[model samples]
Each structure stands twice: as C-alpha cells, then as structure tokens.
Target: MISGLVQILLFQSLGELVSKFLLPTLPGPVIGLVLLVLWLVLRKGINPDLAMVADGFSQYLGLLFVPAAVGVVLFLPQLQANALAIISALVGSVILTIASSAFIARLLSKRESHE
Candidate 1:
C-alpha cells in the first residue's frame, strides 16, 4: 500500500515537473492522472494494494468539498454580485449535460441493439 501510494506521488510529481517545464496551461495533477491511466492501461490492471488505497481515499471524498464550501462562504459577496450570471451558467450547463447524455445514450442503445 505504501509503495503504491509512493508510486502515485512520484508520477504526480513528475507530472508537476513536466507541467512547469513544458505545459504551463495544463494542470500538473491532471497530467499526472493521465499518465497514471495510461500506465494502468498498458499494464492491464491495477495493483490490489493500490486499488485498496484508492477505495480508502474514496471514503473521505466528501471531506474534499469542505474547502470549496468554505471558499463559497468567503466569497459570498462576490457570488451574490454575480448571482444572475452564475445561475444562468449553472442552468445552461445542467440542460446541456442532460441533453447530451440522452443523445449519447440513444446512439449507444441503437448500436448495441444492431450488434
């Protein structure tokens, strides 16, 4: 488990380094996750310990939103000022997401039925 965690961190660090040096626009952790995914795909599976560690981390996922909640509290004034714009964007995104998901589901079902 420790070794698996170390491996993840090492890849994340390498990603950060690469992001700093080569890709200033993309986030380092995102790059690191992409690297991790590619590595896992090539290797054909995840390590048991690594999967266990990931599941453990997933348990506390809700805690990760605490900081963002605090940020919203801190920026309440700014958010209020932009409430209309924010609401519009949120609504628009939700509608778009639902429509796109339905469209994709329809396409997939059609292809699956034919197959």
Candidate 2:
C-alpha cells in the first residue's frame, strides 16, 4: 500500500514538473491527474496493490471537501456582502448543469435503445 501510494505521488510529481516547466499557466495538480489518467489508460490494467491504495484514498474523498467547506466559512463575510450575486450565479450554474446533463443522458439513452 505504501509503495503504491509512493508510485502515485511520483507520477503526480512528474506531472507537476511538466506543468511547471512546460505550462505554468495551468495548475500543477490538474496536469498531474490528467497525466495519471493517461498513464492508467495506456497501461490498460491496474495493479491490484495500487488499486487497493487508490480505493483507500477514494474512501476519504469526502474529507477532501473539508478545506473548501472551511474556505466558505472563512469567506462568509464576503459572501454575505454579495449574497444576491452569489445566489444567482449558483442557481444559474446548477440549472444549466442539470439541463445539460439531462439532455446528454437522454441523447445517449436514445442511441443505446436504437442499437
């Protein structure tokens, strides 16, 4: 498990390095995740040990949102100041996301049923 974790971190570090040197405009970790996905797809099979380690991390995915939750708390004052704008943006985005997702799902389902 430890080794698998280490390997994941190593891949992440490589991605960070590439992003830093090649594309500083983009985020390092986002680049890292993309590289990791590419590597996994190219490999065509996951290592069981690595898979176990990943599953362990996935279990704590909810905990990953803690920092963002804290950030919202910290910025409560600012948010309150612009509550209307924030609420409008949040609602608009949510509606758009739901509509788009529903549309895509319906389209896919239709295609699948035809097949």
Candidate 3:
C-alpha cells in the first residue's frame, strides 16, 4: 500500500516537474494521471498493490467533494449575484447536451441498422 502510494506521488511529482517546465498550461495532476495511464497500459496490467490502493481511494471518493462544497459555500454570495446568468447557462447547456447526445445516438442506431 505504501509503495503504491509512493508510486502515485512519484508520478504526480514528475508531472508537476513537466508542467512547470514543458507544459505550463495543462495541470500537473492531469499530466500525472496521463503518465500513470500510459505506464499502466505499457505494463499491460495494474500492480496488485496499486489496485488495492485505488480501491481504497475509490471508497472515499465522495469525500473528495468536500472541498468543492466548501468552495461553493465560500462563493455563495458571488453565485447568488450571478444566479440569472448561471441558471441561463445551466439550462442552455443541458438542452445542448441532450440534443447532441440524442443526435449521436440516432446516428449510431442508424449505422448499426445499416450494418
């Protein structure tokens, strides 16, 4: 477990270094995740220890939203101030998402029928 955690952190740190030097725009954690994915793909399977560590982390995944909840609370006033715009965007995005998803599904169904 400890070794798995270390491996994860090592990749994250490497990603941070890459982010600092090579790609200043992309986030360090994202880069680190990509690196980790590539490594796992090349290795052809996950290490047992890493799988265990990931399972443990997954169990507490809901806890990760705490910070986001706190952030929303902290910016409550600002959010309230822009509620109109926020609501508008939310509704518009929902409509667009549904429309696009339906279109894609329809196209896929048609293609499948043809084949």
Query: RMSDs, each prediction?
Result: 2.6, 3.0, 2.5
Instruction: lDDT for model 3, please.
Output: 0.96
Candidate 1 yields a Cα-based lDDT of: 0.93
Going through the candidates in order, what is the number of backbone clashes in each?
Answer: 0, 0, 0
Tens-place lDDT digits, model 2, residues 7-100: 7898789878988899988788788888878888999988887899999999999999999999999999999999999899999999999999
Please report the TM-score between candidate 1 and the true structure: 0.79
- TM-scores for all candidates: the values are 0.79, 0.75, 0.78
Candidate 3: pairs in clash: none
Residue runs of model 2 more than 4 Å from their true location after superposition = 94-115
Question: Which of the predicted structures, 1 or 3, would earn the higher lDDT when compared with the native?
Answer: 3
Segments of candidate 3 deviating more than 4 angstroms: 94-115
Alpha-carbon lDDT, every model: 0.93, 0.90, 0.96
Better model by TM-score: candidate 1 vs candidate 3 = 1
Q: Compared with the true structure, what per-residue lDDT tens digits does model 3 show for residues 1-115?
A: 9889998998999899999999999999999999999999999999988999989999999999999999999999999999999999999999999999999999999999999
**Pairs with steric clashes in candidate 1:** none
Instruction: Give me the displacement of residue 90 in model 3, in angstroms.
Output: 2.8
